[model samples]
Target: MRATAEQLRALRQEVAGLERWQAETTPRRMPLGHAEADAALGGGLEVGRLHEVFAGHGADAASATGFAAMLAARLGGSLVWLRQEQVGREGGALHAPGLSEIGFDPARLVLGLLPDPLTVLAAAGEAARCPGVGVVLVELWRMPRPLDLTATRRLALAAETSGVSVLLLRVEAQAQASAAQTRWQVHSLASVPLEANAPGHPALSVELTRQRSGPPGGPWQMEWDRDRGIFRAWDGGGAALSGPQLPLAAHG
Candidate 1:
């Protein structure tokens, strides 16, 4: 049956309204496995939203990537990671063995190595809208002209519509305005020692700088347990100090 022009117009408006409503709705949260961090996040990380992770230093690229990978691992489903080509040339390439060492499956991963940030963002935008993907990791170094607020908003919208989590890994980039549901600064930390002075699990010091729905949280000491597939609340045997707290209204 053919629809009249008015009926079609009404249907379009209804669809647009529904999309707007979904964009405003709170995404489902998944426990990130740390009590303190989870509490600050109001349960856990918000799935189906855009989040940012900025590396704290030149040497922290690996740490930031690791943190992003761990978060992606916990989010469920296949992982699609889009990274600037320069990142691999400067820092290192994403290795299968290294990924497996941290409990993420190399088999379920899809990667896009793009020449520039714009291309990377283009690929990421498409990946974020894919319902088959559980997480989309956009790894870029420094600030790029194309990654403005407008690009981020589109990515966030894609995430909301597809119920896919997007984690933007920013190495050597300063914080700026964006549509990220949460923003973080992450750096490497010494792993706890083991029996016979063996290597310990992956450890990271992450600070929550901004959150859209709640107050910022963290600067927590987190150690990822590969065998258990969870982040354990760690002090690193007194390896960290309490970070200065942010105002409750900082993001709320």
Candidate 2:
């Protein structure tokens, strides 16, 4: 027999209660491959959450994008990346070979080049809801009005329902109120040169600026390990790179 309207309403209420319980009691953190960062994060970044990364400056756009892309890569699944067309023109498009260097499969990527922030935000919301999509990365040059708190809240909700991680890459933007689980800023650091003056591995100075679930901590020097597809602490010389080598190219 079909259930009565009252019974259906009660069932919906029960399901909502269960979802709340699970959210409160369970935190599925994926270790980010850095001990200090993991400790500050209370283990690691939570899966199925919204994370934001900002460029330390316009010149750091490459590092910021690379940081977000690396996180999406670590998430491990089909990646849907949405960005404004202008971003590609200004900060360099997502290059296939560059991605390959970092262990991200180009075949698993779905790239969307939209005309404006509104379009990108709309696409990002939908992508976050898609099943089988491992990660949704939305790159915005600056904080646009269309990507307000309400928009992020929707994205966060979609991520929670679909169990997909959403990465927001903000270049030349300031931090604002949002529903992001964690917020970070990345700046390129001159890598320690390898044998015979070969440029060092991709090194970056990263800071965990904010978070909703754990104490904010960081400002760590990190190196991207392409072979392992993870961020490792960089201890080259035990000091931040200096002089002309401090500035890295915009790709990585």
Candidate 3:
């Protein structure tokens, strides 16, 4: 049956109200530890969304994993680390000295050593659906098939609906195009130098390769204190080490 103009107008208004309510009610924002990183991420990592971290090479994988773990710790939720490939054997362990310093409780961490990428993805989705689990980290360095839109969309939808923050850790060499909300490419620079007044090691040079929503250039020089087990920004004027300038690239 054809609807009259008045009825159609009323229906449209109802739909609009629903849309507005959803926008206002949906919670989207996870706290990334670093202020700069959070700002760069457009108000932290969006809660209930899939975030992809692509490390340009093998060396960057550990840093990416550590960084993701740190972020998870700050969000105050249970962390599920899904190990893909031989990530378990190949220094995929999240026990960075920096983590302890940064205040991440070892007890709250849950580790899953899944060699199969598909299995890992499936489990991550399931964990996200579970109300108790807060964050799920899927390490996909050695997945057989490249991540494409289909897989990413599935994860993204799961995150959105379940209100879980998902981090996809991929090797830069292995990563292909994906439909993730945030595709971050990470590159490690040199470590930050130890300060004269302080009695510890310096920070590391972490370059932001790509950010989907925010400005990209950052030799975002950061420092990880071994003794303290935390990361801090390097103050360049002191004896701290400084990495090369990271120029932002045009959005892909």
Off by over 4 Å in 3: 1-22, 31-35, 92-102, 172-174, 195-202, 207-217, 224-231, 236-238, 241-252
Q: Which ten residues in a row have the lowest lDDT in candidate 1?
A: 238-247
Give the Cα error of residue 76 in candidate 3, in Å: 1.9
Candidate 3 has its poorest 10 consecutive residues by lDDT at 193-202
lDDT of 2 by residue, 1-252 (tens): 599999989868866975886668675788889889988999899888899999999999999988888998888999999989987778887898989888899999999999999999999999998988999999988769998887998888788877889999998999989999999999998797775557878899989999897778889989989899888989876553443445468897
lDDT of 3 by residue, 41-153 (tens): 66666776777776757777766766666557655688887876566677545564556565677677788877587788778778877667788888776555735677887
- For each candidate, the alpha-carbon lDDT, in order, equals 0.88, 0.88, 0.66
Give the poorly placed runs of model 1, Cα more than 4 Å off: 1-15, 18-20, 23-26, 239-252
Candidate 1: tens digits of C-alpha lDDT, residues 1-252: 599999989878866975887768866899989999999999999999999999999899899999999998888789999987777778888898999888899998998999999899999989998999999999888889999898998899888888899999998899888999999999888877665555577899999999998998879989998788889976656643234333477565
The residue pairs that clash in candidate 1, if any, are: none
Q: What's the distance in Å from true for residue 216, model 3?
A: 3.8
Model 1 residue 179 lDDT?
97
